[model samples]
Target: MTTSLMHTSQQNQPLISWRWLSLALLVLCIIAFASASTSWLRISPDRQLQISQLQYFLNVGISYCSWLVIAVFANWMRLRIPLFSEKHPKWLLIHCSVAALISLLHILFDTFMLGLLFSFDFNFVSAFAKKVAFWLPVEMVAYLACVVSLSLLEQHKKNLKLPESEQSYTFEQGNQVRVVDRQDIEYIEAYDNYVFVHCANERLMLKQSLSSLAAKLPDEFCRVHRSYLVNLMAVECFESHSDGQAFSRLKSGKCVPVSRRRKMAVKSSLAALHTHIH
Candidate 1:
């Protein structure tokens, strides 16, 4: 290839990267810092400012930081698990457990720890958890929805079915084989340890774990279940099973089951995209 062509190919390589998450979190941190220092939120329950103002902002800032840390950690953990872009059972378990643990810690710190240390009666722990619970899941769900929607769009593009809004990992050794998307992707099927990516237009076999490929996939493909990652844009119809199994029927005429747990999420993602259209 000519230098210009080679440069263009390099530039056209997928722009999917998570380094932006850090930048986003930093911006949020700055916002929290600024918001905390402002006089908007009062120091105490009372409107009259009787006590010194230092404590209020300090507590708010601390709470914001704590929540931000929890969020970042949760996303990192979710991304770390190799589940082929699907939500892993262990991921959910860990998320709930860690979130609970953090809740307890936040409670202890804000309630007994802070109150006892400062001689204040505020049950900050309970208050903090309550507020955090209210907001955290919503944010997480929104991000997940975005990722799913984008993945679906990518799948559609691959099949030449639709033009989409194109807003779109490391390893070791031969065991950590890097996928050359052009040569290796005929179709992808998700099982437990591996998502079989058929190359050579379905005559060749290259098996890689779903989690690994998911990390490499552009936004147009998504894990619809533990066992299936389908291109949502290529999805022709979604079917319901009499046995309570939900499945997405793809343009390839392939029917893949959507796990019970992921059904709601898949539907929610589709709904979001539909809303975005109008």
Candidate 2:
């Protein structure tokens, strides 16, 4: 069983690696195009361009390299500090603040590179002001475009990995092992050192952690609480309490309490499911 799980995980490794590689290649292509376009625009027939084509390419390359570094950092930060997550109530404010800081850093690096390549004196305040006025909007759009595209790609990958109805979950009970179809599972709850798997009319106890089982389950199985994993299809509706508590009411009339931390994520998942169904 362990070997099978390991094999499945190994199969997924290459696809995950490819996604990152694709993102990197996409960013490089965008940077190259932008650099070439900007450099071409600098060469005008009517006006005398201050910098040569080689110098302009070098400057643009430096600027794009700086942006690439910033983009990598931003992606890392986005993973750690995910905006628009339930845990992040002030996500918009935090996102805006981070964008401002990134823009400032981008402008600073770009200016430094311009000065280095062109041997031009940079007035810090004036340069920053000019960048903010002219470059910030373009930078913001580019940053958003990259992030959004990568995010959509990730979602597409996840959708492709969604478990089929025939997929089975294996568990050990006492000295015997049993395999249960995923569609047969109503919900899973953690109790002491064992996890209780609730099915249509049978409840099976397995010596496993909820977290471990969650990783193997499909997207339909959501972690509504620290100790519970509820199949979204089994959920009839969500029950609310005056004390700001909530419970997921399953079709079997079983109420699974949802933790405050996971409520928004669960709600979003349910909403997405609803939309998909309709």
lDDT of 2: 0.66
Q: Could you tell me the TM-score of candidate 1?
A: 0.42
lDDT of 1 by residue, 119-189 (tens): 55555656666756765565445434444454455445444532222221111224343323332333457
Clashes of 1: 9
Q: By summed lDDT, which 10 consecutive residues of candidate 2 come out lowest?
A: 2-11
- Error at 231, model 2, angstroms: 0.5
The number of the candidate with the highest lDDT is 2
TM-score of each: 0.42, 0.56
Per-candidate clashes, comma-separated: 9, 0
Alpha-carbon runs more than 4 Å astray in model 2: 1-124, 133-135, 154-166, 172-177
Give the per-residue lDDT digits (tens) of candidate 2, residues 1-278.
21112111111232235357557756765776576567657756733253455446555665665567556655644544454556568855665566667777777776765565445555767766887887677666666555555556545645575444336666555565666776778898888877888898778876667777676666778889989999899999988788989999989898999998777677767765665566
